[model samples]
Target chain A: MVAKLKDQMTPAERASALARGEKVDRLPCNPNIANGAARIYGCKISEFNTNAKALAEAQIAVYRRFGSDSIRIFTDLFTCAEAMGAKAILPEDNTADLLEPAISDLSQIDRLRPVDPYKDGRLPVQVEAMKYLVDAIGTEAGCSVGVVGPFTNSFFLVQMEKALQLICKDPEAMHKLCRISLESCKAWAAVVMDMGLTPTISEPMSSCTVVSPRVFREFSLPYLKELVDFIKSRGRGVTMHVCGQTNKIWTDLADLGIAGMSIDNVASIRQCKESIGDQVKVLGNVDPGSVMYAGTPMDVRLATLECIRDGYDSPKGFVVMSGCSLPVETPVENIDMMMDTVREAGYPIDIEWVEAEIARCKQVLGK
Target chain B: MRTKEELLAELARCVVEMEDDSVADVAREYAEAGHDPKEGILNGLIIGMNQAADLYDQEEYYIPELLICSAAMYNGLDVLKPLLPQEKQENEQKIVIGVVQGDTHDIGKNLVKIMLEAAGFTMIDLGRDVPVERFVDAVRAENPQVVALSTLMSTSMQNMGRVVQLLEEAGLRQQVKIIIGGGPVSTAFARKIGADGYSVNATDAVHLVRELLGA
Candidate 1:
């Protein structure tokens, strides 16, 4: 069955098409579909965070309605933490975050053990949701599963404040926590990849800009490399999403085993492409909150086009997207405007369209 | 009279000890020893605070440590301010700082506040989740030279922009440098929002503030 599907359009082919390195019918619209899906499917943000069924349904609806190539289900930050017996809080208006980890003391690490994703707490729900999604649309569309990075999980387990202290005070414990997070991540990645979907890890806290490069090297990169290799070894593609000015670390990330990077807007695309785009696929830099939330449709359009224009033109693996998660309240038309900008442009952005886009933005913002 | 080095050593000891009584005692000793208050702030308290900032950057200390040290510096400065000449007492540049509306993240803001104060800048912190009107009202009342706005979440970054625009509309923007910084704030976003300056990290924040103040 997989062979037959590959004969028609391979993963490389699909990746190539999205990257604009190869010619395709249209640009791939793959938003990091998260809580916005819940809002789209009429599930309250509260329910979306807490209820598995609501979360799954909303993700499906978002993929179907938006024609997105991929749908991201784990919108909340507390995925692996909750699985590890951390207390998580699901605020109605805010993102789901881990309240406290079960491992408050170094001695607790021995007591706490990794769980099978199918039998674990929220991990099971996420996997089950992915399985349902696979049965429904995974074969037809790209199904992306989100995983937390080692440092973030360490922060969750010991509580952020204590976790930060531990990183400086007890480097050994931090590494121990990272090891646990890495193992759990591999187990979790296996569950998602079994559904024949790609796996993407959101490394929100592991940015060199967030922590020192030395700390990242000590605490994050090793686990990241292990997890990326583990996921890829299972025959699934991996993309690591890091939120911050990580231009300095693009080469460091490329040196790791991930297939692609989803970087923030603060990091220069020209520099990232120059440094690591040849080796790995690069995904995003669109300012989601700035352009998608507040800017006019034209702002979205111009910025989207600029992302593609300044792109490495790596046809097979690049995916143009927002630098970070889509804000829950982001205007739908603004997203539409981004897609429209890309769709209107061919492989390369024509100069006339660039001028027209600039005009449109100026007109919208009245600048 | 003690040499400048002795006065500075005493001030450093006061910050490390972080007791109000010790800080006040050393502050009076420094003043009675005939050192300039502004010079004591620059050479003594500022050095200790920068050390704390360095400690934070190097992961040697955390927020609580910085806060307590800042409190110590403040305590010593309180005692020193009264004895100093009027001009020297007013020498520290005053700035207004706050987290923009709908954002409750104050840890980063307070870090900036402490670092600024440690750098010898007088800060009027409006605390977290500050409305735009309050920023403007504070600007009108306090007439600070720089208004530093902070927001952790990407969603509330718009409020920083709104505050800037509101200030601009009220014809107060030109009067103050609108600086925005936090986890989510980027230099490009700050430029888009028409902010005067943006810094990615805390140390850069101090430099940005000094540059804005032309100090």
Candidate 2:
């Protein structure tokens, strides 16, 4: 068994020091565990998301087990949109599937109204979960709630293909939908901020892999900038996660004045560190599917070390995280290996040792 | 007063330019000019769709552009398809496709379907949130040349493999090629699940089907 390395500071202290550009005991690690928390807490996926107590208890359980730096409150990206009259099909053991969009046609744009976090759909459940988490572990570890970005939320209000079609065929209607979606986002963020938590934007649909950088510039960027500015105006820093290829818009994303960016595994972390590391804190991007969910412990250790090697010396800071939400079926041992690897290779990472270990892990894993 | 060549070129240009609202008028004009409807579809709309695919491959166009271009192609198809002699539509190669069970995200599946249709395969779309039994039933009913499964979530990825298993158990696996694609699926996962192939994108999906069916 690998001996555990002792941390010199609590997660909160480490996060504070890192924000202030000071040294800390270890590299902060957050594997973007969301649904997986329910598995750890021994509850059905449906209950874990809908019941605030279950959600909070599950997150606390995962944090206790993995000792990741942050308690991330995320159910799915569609919660806010679901609140605004979109129909979703909930499964007993999977995230809710959107059944019907709120505005199936642009002609129905008038039907969308800003959500009330406390009274609408599942936003209240999420807010209640945040309250429980903040009261329980807010002082010991950092906490953030996943808020869907305006552009992605807009698509949730309409069918995705129709929404993309509107980008070329009907820009005005697209803007109208996005304008209303932004209002829902702000309402949710305001609720989160009132509880003193950062609202991390998860914009899975806005990735360049789905839409071109030009589309992002015209449709997503302006709205994202407004959301980020609004968060900043509240005197809170914001982080963002875009789920697939983002290298095309690294500079544009950096220009948003975001404090941190969670890159997907599909994008090059090394390039991200080089291009925008000086501007924003770089977090991410181990392969959540191949490594964390499908591979063995050794594979997890190797990927974790590789991420630390690539991102450890960023000018702003770095947080080791999964490329996206950890699949609910990810083996617990793989997560243990990730945390162990991070703990073993704590701050002032020994480049020589990390390189050697990476080599050894690769050989053992036959990669 | 235009030549057949001029009409075909105009049809293709309308699609490539994403003239979704007007491509059908060009198709109707081609039909009114006593041109071959099949020629109008093959040399006109499909050619333009292929050009759009090439642009998507080159990153000169993206999803929004592809979606609109496909709309144009479909609009043109609506005008030209019924004008075809009945027997012409019967022998096209067929493929069954869907987003696997427990996953509802279908833009990727829709793109692949569009590309395959543009490439001339008749797609038996099961749509999203398809149960595993439905896949086996479709193969029994359609006898398609290929079965393509998709899922954006890793949790539902196992259902793709289940479909393969049920097909084999029903003694139907030998008749069709199985292909899978999506955000979390990989060639390694495809091989593990005994699928015939995996594609990384919609364009590649069309090529994979062709290669699998030896088309």
Candidate 3:
């Protein structure tokens, strides 16, 4: 049997203490398990996403099984866009797919309206799930609802190809679309806060892999600042996850006054910690695809240990997590190994042992 | 009254500058000047696209710039392609590409298609959310030298492997080289799925295809 490290505090207490600039038992670990929760609870992705009880129960099962630091509620990135009238294909066993944008042209932007969390598309499904989770296990762990950032939601409204073209062809129209998307985000986030859950922002399209930093500043940054300020004004801390290479915008994103930032595995967590560790808490970046889904238990252990060694000492704080959301088919044992490694390493991580183990693991995993 | 050299330079500049509206005018000017339509495409618009690709490789231009440049290239192609002899229209190397089933994110796939087309390869674009059967069928129908599969979603990534298996079952796997790419895909994944290769970005994909074809 593998040895497991004991937790000295509950997940909620650990998370709270970490945010308050205090330390506790072990490193707070969250693998961004969202749709993957369905697998743990034995439900199809479609059933889990549409049914509030299934969503909440699956999340609870994940929390119970992994003792993860947070319960994340997110059906897909297109939830807000779908609510605003974009069409999507909901597969029986996979996440929803966007079929067509709400408006094909920016001229039709005026036809779109802000989404009402209670009344829009699947937004209500997400809200109801949050309600159930908070009611059931609110005090035991941190709960967050993943909301699409304005830039990505705007792309969903007009399709990414059109949105990118609009950036060079019609700047004003792009801004108008983003503004509408921003309001939708605020409206949905306002309701999440009302339920006492943090709203984590996801802006996959804003990553440097997709757009230039110049474009990000012109198109995504301003709207993100406004949304982050709105969330902070409500006295809630917010975190952001941008799903590709984001090293170019670390300084820009850090300037947004966000409480924490989730780094994608493609980017270096060590560089992120060195650059912005003082300004914001760093949560990330195990390779969700290579290490979590395709790797073995030992690979997860090595990757988790390597992440801790690199990020454990950030001045602001660090929460070990997957580089992005785990693929639904990720082996449960790999996730368990991640938690077990964090438990064994515990707080006041031994740099020497970690360093040696990292080398050995890298050699064993052929990194 | 511009000379042939002057006309070609303007054609290239129009594409590099993303002058989509003016590129057609420049190509028409080139065509009227009796400059070889093939020279206009190969030396003019294609050169500009390669320059833009260089900027992209250097990170000076990103997807938006690349998209607009490609649009300009296509506009220029619209004017010059019709003037070319039928033999000039055919390219020796043909490649079929698509985003695998259950994934609609095609920005990467489209970029690869543009770069491959600009590099003088004939491309049969299967578009986004293409089924595995379609890929196998396209392989049988087109008999292209290479097949490219892409997906942004991990859930749909398995379909790439399924496509490979289907092609093998259909006895068409040995007929073409298979390459895979996307956000979650890695070289290891390419190897695991028995693909011929994987490239991280669109620019490298051109070189990968060339190398795979031994061109």
After superposing candidate 3 on the true structure, give the runs of residues whose Cα lies further than 4 Å from its correct spot.
A4-6, A19-23, B88-91
What does the lDDT come to for candidate 3? 0.90
* All candidates: DockQ: 0.21, 0.66, 0.77
Per-residue CA lDDT of candidate 1, range A1-367, in tens? Answer: 0011111343335555655555564445455657777678886777754467777788888765665556777776677777788887677765765556767778888766665788766776676677677777735667778888777777777776566656655789888888888888888888777866677888877765556666777788888888888877787668888887677667788887678878887776666777787888778877777677766776787777677766636533466788888877888887666666655664444656666766766676676
lDDT of each: 0.73, 0.89, 0.90
Candidate ranking under lDDT, highest first, comes to 3, 2, 1
| TM-score sort, best first | 3, 2, 1
Q: What is candidate 2's lDDT per residue for A145-261, written digit by digit as tens?
A: 989999999887988777888888789999998899999999999999998788999888789888999888998999999999999999998999998899999889889999999
Once superposed on the true structure, which residue ranges of model 1 sit more than 4 Å away at CA?
A1-13, A16-22, A101-111, A119-121, A348-367, B1-41, B48-96, B101-104, B124-147, B158-178, B185-204, B207-215
Task: Return the lDDT, model 1, position A298.
Answer: 69
Clash pairs detected, candidate 3 = none
Please tell me which model should have the higher lDDT, number 2 or number 3: 3
> On residues B1-215, what C-alpha lDDT tens digit does candidate 2 reach at each position?
88899989999999888999989988888999899999999999999999999999998898888888898999999999898888846667999999998787888999999999989899999999899999999999999989999989988777988999999999999999999998887787788789999999999999999888787
Stretches of candidate 2 exceeding 4 Å from the true structure? A1-8, A20-23, B88-92
Per residue, candidate 3 scores C-alpha lDDT tens digits across A1-367 of 3676567888989877767867778888998787888899999999865798998889999988888988888878888998999998888987888889999766788999999999988888888888899999958887899989999999999987898999999999999999999999999999999998999999998999989999999999999999999999999889999989999999999999999999999998899999999999999998888679877888888889889999999998889999988898999889888888888887778889889888888898687
Q: Between the candidate structures 2 and 3, which one is better when assessed by TM-score?
A: 3
Q: Estimate, for each residue in B47-68, the C-alpha lDDT of model 3 and write its tens digit.
A: 9999999999999899999999
